[model samples]
Target chain A: MGSLEYRCLKATGVYNVLSEALVEIRDVNFAYGHRPILKGMNLTFPKNKVIAIMGGSGCGKTTLLRLIGGSIKPTSGYVKIGGQIIHELDRAGLYAMRRKMGMLFQFGALFTDMSVYDNVAFQMREHTNLPEEIIHDLVMMKLHAVGLRGTHDLLPAELSGGMARRVALARTVALDPMLILYDEPFAGLDPISLTVVGNLIKRLNDALGATSIVVTHDVQESLKIVDYLYFVADGVIITEGTPDEIKASNKPFVQQFINGEMDGPVPFHYPGGDYQQDLKLKSIERVKNNKRKVTERYFGLDRRQKKK
Target chain B: MMAALTKNFVGLGRRVMNSLWRIGIGARFLSLILLNSGISFSRFHLTVKELFFSGVMSLIIILVAGMFVGMVLGLQGYETLKRYGSESALGSLVALSLVRELGPVLAALLFASRAGSAMTAEIGLMKATEQISAMEMMAINPIARVVAPRFWAGVFAVPLLAAMFSVMGVFGGYLVGVVLIGVDEGSFWSQMQSNVDFQHDVLNGVFKSCVFGVVVTAIALFEGYDAPPTAEGVSGATTRTVVESSLAILILDFILTALMI
Candidate 1:
C-alpha cells in the first residue's frame, strides 16, 4: 500500500514540491579529536524532495550526514528533526529517533555472513513484531523494488559491487522511513548501474514521501535528480541553490568542483613552494656539497700515505 | 636534560594510563556481555552455534596435548619417584598435577590460540567493513547481536574443555604408568581416588578456566571493536588478541593460583 501523501502527490503530479523543514542543522561545529571537520554548518532539508550535499574528498560531507543521524554529536550547536534536538537525546531516545531515519553507507556494508534476503530483512527483524510470513512478503516487496528479488539467497560477497549497493538501497528504504541519508551512494558504480541506482533513489524518495539527503561528489548523477544542492568546502556550505542555479554558480570553489576544472581555488597541485626553483636550488647545493666529500671529508684519511 | 626527563615521565604516565584504560573498557565490555545474555535466551540457537565453533572446535588440541603432557609427566614422575621409593603415589601425582594446574592453563592457552584469535579477526573485519556501523544505523546494537552469543559460548565452553582435558590426561597417565611401566593398578587408582578432592581440585580448576575464558574472549572482542576501521586495523587487532591474551593468561594464572591456594 502506498502512502496517502505519495498517492496524493501522484494525483496532483507535483511530486517534487517540498513543504516545510524536516531537518534543521544550525551553527553545527564538529571535530574528530583536535582536527576540525565541519566548522559551523547551517542548512535545512525540506520534506518531499531530493537534496544533495556535495563536496570534494575530506571536505566533511559524510560528517554532516553522520551528525544528522546522531551517530556522532556536534562539537557545538544543534541538529533538530521535527523540532527535537538530536544531541540531547539519551541512548534509548537517540535510538528511537534513529528508527525514523535510514542511511546508506559509502560501500554496501552488508553483513558478509548473511545472505541478501537477511540483509534486506535486518531492519524489519530488529524493529518490527510482524510474523515471518509478513516479514518475508515485505522483504520480497523491498527486494522487488530494487529488481533484486532473484538474488535473495546470494551472500553479499557473491553479488557484484552494483548488486550489493542495490541491496543496500532496498534495505535503507525497507521501513519506509521519514528521512534517508545516502553517503556516496553512486560511488564505484558502472554507468548502467549508476543510472539504475540514481533513478531508484529519486523514485523511492518520491514514492515513499521521504525527505532525502545525498552526500556525494558524483555531480552528474546528483544534478540529475537532486532538487536542491549545497556545495561544501573547508568545513562550510559555500554555495546552495537549485541544480540549475548551482550549474550557473560563479563561486570559484563551487565552479571548480561542479565544473570538474583542473585548477581554481582548489588547486590541482599541492600547496608548496615553486617546484622548479626548489629543484634547481637543491641541485646547486648538492653540487657544492659533493665537491668536498671524496677524501677531505672522510677521516682526513691518508690511508694511501699510511700504506706507502 | 629537563626535556628528556619530562618526556620519560610523560611516556611512563601514558603507559600506565593506557593500561588502566584498557582494563576499564574490558570490564565494561564484560558487563555488557552479561546484560546481553538475558536478552539472548530467546536466541538459543545462535549461542549453541557459537559453542560449537569456539568450544567444540577446540576439543582436538585439548585432547591431544593433554594426553602427551600426561605421558611426559608419568615418565618424569616415575623416574623421580624411583630414587625415593615413592613410585606407589604416581596415580596421585598425575591426577593432582593435571586437575590443579596443567588442564586449565594449557587448555586455556590452546583456546586462546585457536578460537580467540579467530573471534578478534572476525569482529575486526566486520568493523573495518562498516558492518558494525550499518547495524548501528539500523538502530541495532552489534554487541547484543554479534558479541554476546560468542561471549557466552566461550564462558561455558572453556571450563568444559578443561575438564575434558583433565580426564584425558589422567587416562593417558594410566596408559603409561600402570599398563606400560608395570605399576600396581590397584594402588594407582586408590591413591588418586583418595587424594583428589572434588571441591578443592576439580572445582577450582573449573573456576579458573571459566575466568580465563572470560578474560581471553573479552580481550579478543574489545581489541576488535576498538580497532581502527582499516585493513591494517583488523590485522593489528588479531595480533593484539594473540599477544595480549597469552600474556593475560600467564599473569592471571599466577595471581589466581596464588590466591586460590
Candidate 2:
C-alpha cells in the first residue's frame, strides 16, 4: 500500500497500484506533412516497469517512441519525462536528458562498420573519459548479460539475426540508462530467440531498475513479460490495463488484436466500391464484347496456351 | 484548351516553387554542417578515413583519365602546331589546357561520379536502415559525427585529387610528346616553364578545384541527409547526387572562369 496507489484507488475507484510515471505524454498530436500519425494521445509510463505499447504496424507506435526520445517535437501538447518537458529542452539539455535514455531500434540498427565490441562500447567511449581497460570490462559485462560474451569480435553482418538483436540489446543497456525504449524487439526472431530476448528484456529492466517502453504487436510474448499493456489503434490508446485486465478485456479492438482476428475493426480488404457491383460491371462488359479469347487474354488465362 | 494551358502554367509554377524550396533547405543544411564541423576537426581520424574512401580510392580513375586526356591533347596540339610550324609550342599548349581548364573540370566531374554518389548512397542507406535515428537516440549528433567528417574529407580531398590529376596529365603529355613523338626535350621543358604562370594559371586552377569540391560534396551530403528513408529513396538520391553535382561543378566552373579571366 503505497501512498500513490491509495491516491490512484481513491481517484479512479480502481485498485491500480502504478508506480510514479517516468514518462508523461499529454494530449500529444503529431503528423508528417499532411499525414497525421498520432492524434491527441495521452499516456503514462511508470518508473521501472516493462510497459508494452501493442499496436498493428504503422499505428504510430514508433512515432510515440521518437516523441519520447525528443527526436521530433509533437504538433501540439507536451511530452514530459522526469518532470521536464522534452521538446522545450535546449540542445545541451536535450542531449543531457537523452544520456539517461536508451533506445533499441527495430532491426538492431547496429553500426555496420564496427565490430560488436566497438558497437556496445560506442556510447561509453563517446560520453565518458574512462580508460579503454574499464570500457572493455564494461562492454564484456553487458555482452555477458545478454548471453553473448563470445561474439564481441564479430561484425554485425557476421552474426545471425538473433545474435545481432542480442548484441543490440547489450549495446542499448551499456550505459545502464534510466529509461529503455524497444521498437519491435521481437520482430523477425525465431520462437526460441524471441523467448530468450523477452526474458533478457525483463531481466535487464529489473537489473538496471529502468523503465522500458516496448512497442510491439507480439501479443502472447508481451503478455508473458509486461507489467502493463497499452493497446493503440487509429493514433489513440484504445484500451489499457495490466496483463490480466488486458486478457479479460471485452473491448472489440483488444479482442481482435489479442485473438489475431482478421475482418474486425481492421478490415481484411482494402476500402473500395461494392465488390458485387464491380463484378456485375465486368460481366456486362464481357458480354457486350462477346469475346472469350480476348477475355482470357486480358485476364492472363491464356498465358499457359501462349507458352505452349 | 484554356484549362489545359492553365494547368501547364500551374504545374510549371509548382516545380519552380519546389526547386526554390529545396535550394533553401540545402542552404540551411550547409550551415548546419559548418556549425557542427568542430567534431570533424577534433576527431581527425574520421575525416582521414573518409579521405581514403573519397580521395585515395579515386586515384586510379583520376590518374588513368588524366593520362588519356593529356595524351590526346599532345597528339592534337602537335598536329595543329605543326601546321603553323610552331610545333615546339606543343608543351605550352598541353600545359595551359590542363592547368587552366581541363584538369579541374574533368577531375571534378570524375570525382562527382565516383565519390559524391558513394557518399549519398552510404548516408541514404544509413538513414533507410535507421542508423542516423539510432545515433540521435544515443545523444550523438549525426551531422557532427558522420556528415561533417565526410564533408570535410571531400573538401580536402577534391583539390588534392585535382592536383594529382594535373600532374599525371603533364607526365602523360611528356611521355607522348618528348618521348614518343621525338619532340626536343629541352624545348618542351623550357617552353612549358616559360608559358605556364604559377600565379595566374596554377593558382586559378586550384581555386576552381576548391570551389568544385565544395559544390560537389555539399550537394551529395544534402541530398543524402534529405533523402526519404527507403530503398527507392536512397537510389534516387544517389542518382540525383551525381547529376546535381555534375551540373553544379560545370556551372560553377563557367562562372569561375568568367570571373578569373
Q: Considering just chain B, what TM-score does every model have?
A: 0.95, 0.99
Question: lDDT of candidate 2 vs native?
Answer: 0.91
Query: Across residues B1-261, which tens digit of lDDT does each residue of candidate 2 receive?
Result: 999999999999999999999999999999999999998888899999999999999999999999989998888889899999998998888899998899999999999999999999999989988899889989999999999999999999888988988888888888889899988998998999999999999999999999999989999999999999988899999999999998898889889999999
**Which digits, one per residue and each the tens of the lDDT, describe model 1 over residues B1-261?**
999999999999999999999889888888888887764568788889899999998899889999988998889989998899988899999999999999998888889889998899999889888899888888888888889988888888889889989989998889899999988999999999999999999888988999999988898888888888888998898899989988988999999999999
User: What do the candidate models score in CA lDDT, each in turn?
Assistant: 0.89, 0.91
Clashing pairs in 2: none
Please write out the lDDT profile of model 1 over residues A1-308, one tens digit for every residue: 12345336535755435356789899999999999999989987778789999989999999899889888899998999978998899988888988998889889899898899999898898899999999999999999999999999999999999999999999999899999999999999999999999999999999999999999999999989998888899999888877877787788888788779999888888778898787798788887667645555575754555467
lDDT of 2 at A265: 91
Each model's RMSD to truth, in Å?
A: 5.7, 4.8
Cα lDDT, model 2, residue A223: 93
TM-score of 1: 0.90
